[model samples]
Target: MPSPAPSSPLLTAFHDSYHELVRFVARRTGPQSARDLVHDAWIRLAERQRSEGRRPEAPSDERSTPSPQNIAPRAYLYTVADHIAIDHLRRGQRTAQRFDSSGKEDGPAFAASPDVADTHTYRQALAEVENALQQLPARCRDIFLADRIDGASHAELALRHGVSVKTVEREVMRAMDGVEAALHRWRGETAAPRTGRRRALSSLLGLAGLGVSSSALWLGWRQWVPQYQLQLATAKRRLLRQPLPDGSTLTLDADSRAELRYYAARRQVQLLAGSAFFAVARDTERPFTVEASDVQVTVLGTRFEVALEGDAVLVAVDTGRVRVRDGSGGVQTLLAGQMLRLPAGQSAQPQAITAVAPWRDGWLDFQNTPLAEVVERLARYSPHPLRVEADAATLPVLGRVHTTAVSGWLQLLARTLPVSVQPEEAEGGISTLVIRRRS
Candidate 1:
């Protein structure tokens, strides 16, 4: 066989760890100086390789061996950043000493006078960058602090949290890009005008991009929102309201979890567990879709709700129209004030939407819904695992239960229905509820 082609190990290493390495540097230095530090690190690495005579002699016939693939690039990149940050701090200390000995204030060179206009501009730019980072998701923020501040490895985090390494990598990428974009916008907006005295102003603006415009900032926000997935999870008896990337909003019910994804051609959400109400924004060019248990709902713009109960999917439309498709390729169109239940291996059964997604108003309305469904819905908000006997599970139930009052609703079931509620305590102070028909 012919000799295998030589790959650029340096390029591969940079590609694998560029985002995370820059984040590591940014935590030590400010975001504004992170780009320069990373660039300097790369230059020094190349110089070291050249001095050591490790440079490849030819593209096809390499003389020097590349860095071993088994060694993670993150460690190597982090080492380079550590040296850069130390040098930066040392230079700053030395400059401070010079100012002290010369009887001069240690302030920015651009702000020579105390009342200079540039001072206010610089402060405002920095404040905006900080505020933007604060608005990022909590998980993203935590990952950045752990990786950059504590110097934790991605594999270490994965093992500690019982998640895959890819999860940590994604979170780091999201936060780094988000902070970088915010700083870029800040620099672009606060760039000074080029004049006789400020001829170097153009060089400052070039760090962000070529041009500075509101459209550019908006486009940056749109593009960055899709790089990493956004997750919304709620604990028992707790509900959450989240804003979507497409200017829409969603309300997740108790014990629910969902993931949002916005692509060029479509805006999609996966209802991983429980129920959620979607107030989708109008986008005819890109239809909004919800993927749930064995069913998918597609709409251009609408107010709708999807509930994943067991193996079935329940869809309700409050406003606009919804198109639901089952796993068997059966399609059903539902309009405002309409609802449907799609059971596993069964066709969609349409019903009149009597209350326009009562859950949106903090109520779970059931009209002749099975007792088993009532128990199942209440279980999401209940602190204990709920179990219903077969006879009681088959009985019909009709009531509007409060989302946050699951215990009260179950108690009412024992009073009105021919069933008894029994609470069992297990080890570790854990409790469970069992409902069965009265003997």
Candidate 2:
């Protein structure tokens, strides 16, 4: 080893270290990039070795400063290789940027050497396995790709998708289990005697009918009953024309809403929120009723409006007789052209009125009803609030106020009333209908 030059210890150490570094880089970057990264480091090392006025081979004592104590050849080569690999990545990145901007690549920047190409073939093999995984069930395919391709842990993936970590683990295991089971079955079929194998194949062919029958049954079941079911229900103000499954008609007024539910035991619909008009379909077995707050407006067969205004629940029957009942079993019957107002709270006494139902012909009919009360009803469907002074509140109105058209009502109110009904402007999107006496 005297004056070590050709086939020297330091030269062998450097070459071996470079090869190891290439293998490490190959795991992350493709093998072509790995060789480029490793070769660049070696090129720098060779240039340095050649510069030091040394022979055509490695120098014996002419080594770079050792990285650690006792300064070994392996440690020095590893240090040099790491720095050169990083620099090669930076330079390659700049070359890629320049090529992208200019739309030209003069030569291959990361071409694989023969040995590096062999390592890169592993990548192609993994890619083929990836394509095979796509044929698996959706959940199984997702778990396999996340674990193998993206290298995500089961726990990490489970938390990301709001599933249990055990679910993720089980999915991956299931895919591997499938492969093992398939391989075992294939081997069993192959090693069997010809007669036995033929019999097994015939048995499998016969079972194909069962698979077809099961598929047909599955289609039939989907047509009949579903395994998973979901439905959304909410109560909000709606039009009166919505037909009930019980063959009843609903004539709900504006700002009046009801939830219509047809359950198995009984057709139970709780007007859980707003008010509504009901035209009950006669079911002597299951009498239709409108329950609001505490009072239930029971009817034999009728067209009626069940209005909720502050503490008073007003029931105006337009057709058949309605039996107004308190939740405590007290009932009062009111006939058509008759309105009943029941006070909310504990006292369930009902007041029967001779007034007509306002919305019978899409007009607001008032038999000496307060002017302010009529104005209040007008404000509900309007895109504005109606406001009147206290002095104008007690003025009695006997005419019918048609509310079907917004413009028609506006014009009618302006012409008939002593109070001038002029529209007013309000802040943001709010509008106000000003009802003041004419000057």
Please provide, for model 2 over 352-404, each residue's C-alpha lDDT reduced to its tens digit, 9 standing for 90 to 100. Answer: 55544455456666667677776666655565677877777777777765565
| Worst ten in a row by lDDT for model 2 | 194-203
Model 2 has an lDDT value of 0.53
Candidate 1: misplaced stretches above 4 Å?
A: 1-228
Per-residue lDDT for 1-439 in model 1, tens only? 0011124365346546666767887898666556545645554454344445553211112233234343445554565567667666555455445444445676442211224443354445445544655788876665654664444656677676677766766676566555555555766654333221111122332312222222222233343333335889998888888887678999998889999877546788999999999999999988888999779999999899998877788898999999999878899999998888888767867888777657667788877877888899888778789988898888888888887788878877877789998898877978888899997
lDDT computed for candidate 1: 0.66
Best by TM-score: 1
